[model samples]
Target: MNAVGVIVEYNPFHNGHAFHLHVAKEQANADIVIAAMSGNFLQRGEPALVSKWKRTEMALKAGADIVFELPYIFATQQADSFASGAVSILEAAGCNSLCFGSESGNIDSFYQTIGFLKNNNELFQQKVKYHIAQGNSYPRATALAFHDLTPNEDMLDLSKPNNILGYQYILSVQKQQASINVFTVSRKNADYHDAYFSSETIASATSIRKALFSENGDIFSVRQYMPETSYNSLLEYKEEYGHFHDWEQYFPLLKFRLVQTTPAQLKNIYEVEEGLENRLISTALESYTFKQFMEKLKTKRYTWTRLQRACVHILTNTTKNEMDRKVEKASYLRLLGMTTKGRVYLNKHKSQLSLPLISKLSLQQNEQIMLDIRASRIYALGTRKNQQRLLEMEFKQPPLILN
Candidate 1:
């Protein structure tokens, strides 16, 4: 079967995402659509308002043929690593193409930019260093350098999340020499970070998340935009728990873990560079809330989300060495959900797969997997029921269809 791949967070599967999936299938003439999705934590360094399993189900019901977990280590990382991890997983799963939403929506321009950057690596590096020396943040510096090289004013607006991730996706595909065809669908209506929602067919996931956290927890407000399966899942989760919001309840445990760990140990955590460990250790002890601690550590060089992710990595004991070791391309596909056609394709290609396909959550001995397991346990500290459920989480059977 011909398949197209998507790398997504689907923090809460919304109408815009549904549109993208439909376009991906139509544009690629694909028989199957696979997604490499973030788990409980998202790239923005926040816990998902709803569970990953529910999101996977929503994706499957919304037209995705298969869904695979993107893993904790990669999910909470920067753009480059996140794209690399997601793309690597999709390639391993036998996908022949990839489709993503882009603000520019001009594949020719994207290719031109990628080609320019590839050919002028030394000049670009020098220009970036020059900008950084002027005290600009890394993103700003890199954007300035890129603009200087290509004189493309539009690409300089790397502040947008999708644009930044899209560039990284192109870069990864080029570097890996992957044969997967690339395609983009123009981003619709709401901006990625915009918290406002409209009655239009396209709505940002951010807006949906905000609505979910509102006092009434009104699913009806955004019900029209979400897939029926996703809306039902949200309602079900809310009915089970008072509200499907608030990750702050886990902050106390996070703080306790931060305080208990030594500075030397904190030094080992991913992104804990250049004495940031000492700052984190000191601030974590004095600040009463996670937000306050993060605020205290925030700088132009280190973004709020980056700092938050670093703290999470520290709390979860994801060391720099551990991240470096797992930096190699993904070696396995951990299936989360799939349709009948997806299962058939997998059955046909299973033995021909270059990487292992994982469906069972057996005890893994690798350091990275062990750390992820421990982090999953820690992530459950917010609620008693969740704690029990997490500990007993089983490897779901294949073809776990939503409907």
Candidate 2:
């Protein structure tokens, strides 16, 4: 009845993800696999290419026994909050371990790095501030600080996407003092940021997204790597909806929110701090697209992704205060999909669970959860078909079986 957990965006659920899921199960010897997945919006501050429900179906078909929605507040955050949110949810779901993919598959190195950061807080903080003042982005500033403290050029490279997130995961586990064992599978095939697909069976989510947006829109091109159910659903959805694309529809709303909020209020949004509010307000007024606005405001002190996430926080109304107040402990275990064995495990552990086990949508009537559900639907304001799909989504049951 033991379970292992994964935190993912599955942004399009490519071959690499399938490999990770398989490895997670094998490594943890888990009877069940649970995933905390991103909702409509992803951590990178962009709308998901596909819907969360569809992604959940893909995960279940690929190997996950259950999937829980990582709330928008946490999903759109930086590495730290993102990891904390996903790990907290998995822990609450009573998972015995967590498995993730990392560029540096060395867990010991990650632990050592975390230990160093913990012991050198004061010096590290001062160095970080000094780097920021020298006009480096937060990631760059962090990298510089690590180099200054550790005197190792290699450690600074940990700012690369997967390594940075991996560090956050280790830090979260350490903070929780949870007994959940941690394991990692080496990332394979394509690099995380590589936009090109390879001939092999495994590919990064970035490459898959690029292919999905390419002129052909051919699911068959990557069919060999994806679960049959996921590929079929994606093709069917694309055919009916002409591809769910872009986050432009929400731009006006975002602008309205930015313009309405005062400098002090903007400063409270995650990633928006230290006079960055003025830049946001000024740039938002002039720029047309979200990407363009972020590009215009990008400074040495803040990376593009960080600025993008801050904009998302503004659009979603997730302030620092609100994020801080969110219960760090897992409060509920939401069941998105599961197998028979997974169901049996849930039934057996239901009484022993620290949090309520959420299955039927009717059971989620709490104000905050309800608001998140509504926001997810609202975020799907892409196309008419998607809009209709969102409006009708409440009636759909969790997809427990592959088609």
Candidate 3:
């Protein structure tokens, strides 16, 4: 079977996601669609609004044939690493093509931008360093450097969040020399960070999430922005867990981690550096909530997302050494859910897969995947479910096999 891939978060699996999934398969003209969905956390350094299990169920019901968990290490990082891990998982799953939503839907533009960056890597790096030295954040610095090299709007815009990830997806494809051809579906109606509902049906995940939280998990407020399957999934998750996951939910635990660990010990957490330990600890102690703590911690040099990612590392006690030990590629394809088509594909290709296909959590013990287990445990604290039940959900539950 010809397979296509999508890298997704599906924080709540809104209509925009459903649209992307539908278009991706049509564009790729593949028999089955596979998704490398982020686990409990997301690339934006925020806890998922729901568990990965419900998100996987949403994906399968929406259009995805299979759902694979993008492990914690890659799922919560910035675009480049996130794209790398997603691409690796897709490749391992035997996808012949990849389709991603982007502001610039032109695939040629991505190749052009990547080729230009590669050719002028030295100059680009120098400019990035200069901008960073000038107090610009790393993401801002990279965008500035890209614009410095290409002053014209002739290439894909790296400043747009989806386009940036799309660019990184193409880069990861080239870097790994994978066999997957990539296509793009231009995002419609809303921007990546739009905080308000801009359309009747299409809304950004950010907007959906913001609305969900602002209304105190009232699924009806954002009902129009999601498919029925997704809408019901949101309802089901809320009914079971009593609350959606978010940074604020885990603030107490984060504060506990912050207050107990010394600055020296805090420095060991990934993304904690440049005396960020002192800032995090001091600010965490003074501020009562995650929002207040982040507000106090924000600086010109560090983005909100960057600080949250650092906090995620701290909350998980993920050390820099732990991440540094992870190799460039994903070691296993952690199946979360699948339809009948996906099962057939997997059964046929199981013997030829590049990475191990792990469905049952009981039989696997890779060190990198230990982070995923640890992350799920940490994620449970953000919800109202019994911690033991959630942990057991991680270990005892089998992959959701949809018919």
Candidate 4:
């Protein structure tokens, strides 16, 4: 009855993800796979191609036993914040180990990097700040700072996307002093950010998303790269919602928010800072599309991902104070979907679990969940269908139990 936890977005449950899930379960030698998945929005600050529920179904079909929603606040955050929140939830779910896909397949390298940085904490912090002051983005700043520390060849490469996230996952587990063992599996065929498909059976989620969007939702074009279950879910979602969710789909509303809200007010939103409001306002007024706006908005101080996340905060009207008040650790595990095996594991572990396991949104009353609620409303807003009907589903819908 042992369980292993994986931090995932499953933006579309493609072949690469299915591979990771299976390998993780096998490596951990666990009976159940618990996934801490991002909701409507992803870590890169983009809306998901499909809704969380649809993705949950894809996960269950792909082999995950239990799927938990990583709250919006954490889901749309940078790697460190994102990892910390997801790790906390998995630990709270009573996982015996954590498994992540990384460019550096060796788990020991992540431990080496974490321990090396922990011993050089002061210098590392100073270097990061110094880089930020020099107009580097947070990820860039961290990469520079990591280089400044001169980590050994045995250390994981913080420059790579998966490695950076994996490093943070292990670091988070250690910082929280959780008893979960950590493991890593090597990414195969395609890297995390690969934008072109080169492999026959494996492709990066980015490449799949790009292909799907560019092909105008021709699911068959990318069908070879994802499981049939994922392909079917995409078809179902397109039928019900009319189209897949993306930042381009949300741009008009986001532009409206940027134009209407005063710069002083934008400052209040989470992640908005340092006269960025003024810059964003100017960009919104001139640009008709998200792509045009992003082109004008890109700066060395902000990565494309960071800027998108800030834009997400703006669109959701999530304030700095609201995010600041909530503890970074998991106070609750919001169950999105599960298989019968998953339900059994939960029922057996319910009493021993440290956090409340929430299945229905209406039943859980916590301030931390408010951001998630707001995110869902915004996600529904992106759709062309009955907005109110979609919003209602957020509350009325129970966790998807895959039998």
Candidate with more favorable, higher TM-score: 1 or 2 = 1
| Runs with alpha carbons beyond 4 Å of true place in candidate 1 | 153-157, 215-217, 384-386, 394-399
| CA shift of 29, model 1, Å | 0.4
Model 1 C-alpha lDDT per residue in residues 145-191, reported as the tens digit of each score: 87777555434245567878888898888778788899888888878
Task: Report the lDDT tens digits of candidate 4 across residue range 1-403.
Answer: 8999999999888998998899989988999999999998888989988888899999999999999999987898887789989999998899999989899999888778888998999999999999999989888998899999888888878899999998888878988999899988899889989998999989999998898889465678889999998888998888888888889989999999998999999999998988899999999999989999999999999889989988999899989987773567867899999999999999999998888988888634776788888888899999876667768877988999999
Q: Give the runs in model 3 whose Cα sits over 4 Å from its true position.
A: 215-217
In candidate 4, list every pair of residues with a backbone clash.
Answer: none
Pairs in steric clash, model 2: 136-300, 137-300
TM-scores for all candidates: the values are: 0.92, 0.89, 0.98, 0.97
Q: Each model's number of backbone clashes?
A: 0, 2, 0, 0
Q: What does candidate 2's lDDT look like per residue over 187-208, in tens digits?
A: 8867899888775677777777
Worst 10-residue lDDT window for candidate 4 reads: 322-331
What would you estimate as the lDDT of candidate 3? 0.89
Error of 4 at 253 (Å): 0.8
Estimate candidate 1's RMSD in Å: 2.3
Give me the overall lDDT of model 4.
0.89
How does model 4 score by TM-score?
A: 0.97
Residue 81, candidate 4: C-alpha displacement in angstroms:
1.6
Residue 290, candidate 1: Cα error in Å is 2.8
